[model samples]
Target: MTPVTSRVEYSPIKRARVYMKHEMGIPERRIALEEGISPGSVSGIIRRYPIQKDATSCARSGRPPKLSDRDKRAILRLIKKDPYITTHNLIVAAGLDVSKRTLLRWLKHEGIVHKPAF
Candidate 1:
């Protein structure tokens, strides 16, 4: 027999319980009055809710890091070695297989002030 994994996903209302009780140091009814929510709803949330455990704050991991340390160093080195290098020329010399937008993003991340290409 395989064990079932029971994951409890509490609603925002439920999460509000702990915040109201422990953090806010007030009853649900008072909280609801201040927040403009009904006292009954707050009571329901407080009564039938599980307290949230302290979880490590993890990054959302939406997008990956644009430039690696090596890439950043390479860019800084290139700029320092020759301040006259254009964005187009740098992209070619650095051999970074990315669009001009991506390249610009990398430059921006490295705090490199890029002149508008006329």
Candidate 2:
């Protein structure tokens, strides 16, 4: 059987222990020994403590919006002025740099209904 290892590095439990050690002025080596982790791992945790303190397990992912609130408002105004404006026309009129699909998705997200080209 393999030997048991220390708690997972960067885990909440390990981070908490690292914080406690840091607060109590405990040495990295001692904390490593007590927690069955490596001194380097403990050191890394201590170094990153400040930044990680406010972090949770779940991190926000994905790219930010290409269009800002002002841009979105401009698109809304254009749509309001002419309800029959096509997505292509809207992109050109508003100087939006996003693709047609992205614009359509944004419109859908903003609850803007597109009229059929009947």
Top model by lDDT, which number? Answer: 2
Encode model 1's per-residue lDDT on 24-115: one tens digit a residue: 57866677776566676566555544443332222334566666678767878898999889878887887766678877776775578757
**Which candidate has the top score in TM-score?**
2
**Which residue runs of candidate 2 sit more than 4 Å off their true CA positions?**
1-49, 52-61, 115-118
lDDT of 2: 0.78
Please provide TM-scores, in order, for all candidate models, with all chains considered together: 0.44, 0.49
Which parts of model 1 are misplaced by more than 4 Å? Answer: 1-55, 114-118
Clashing pairs in 2: none
Tens digit per residue, CA lDDT, model 2, 4-102 = 666453668767777788789987888989988788878877777677645234344667778888889899899889988989999999999999998
TM-score of model 2 (CA atoms): 0.49
Residue 33 of model 1, lDDT score: 72
Q: List the residue pairs that clash in candidate 1.
A: none
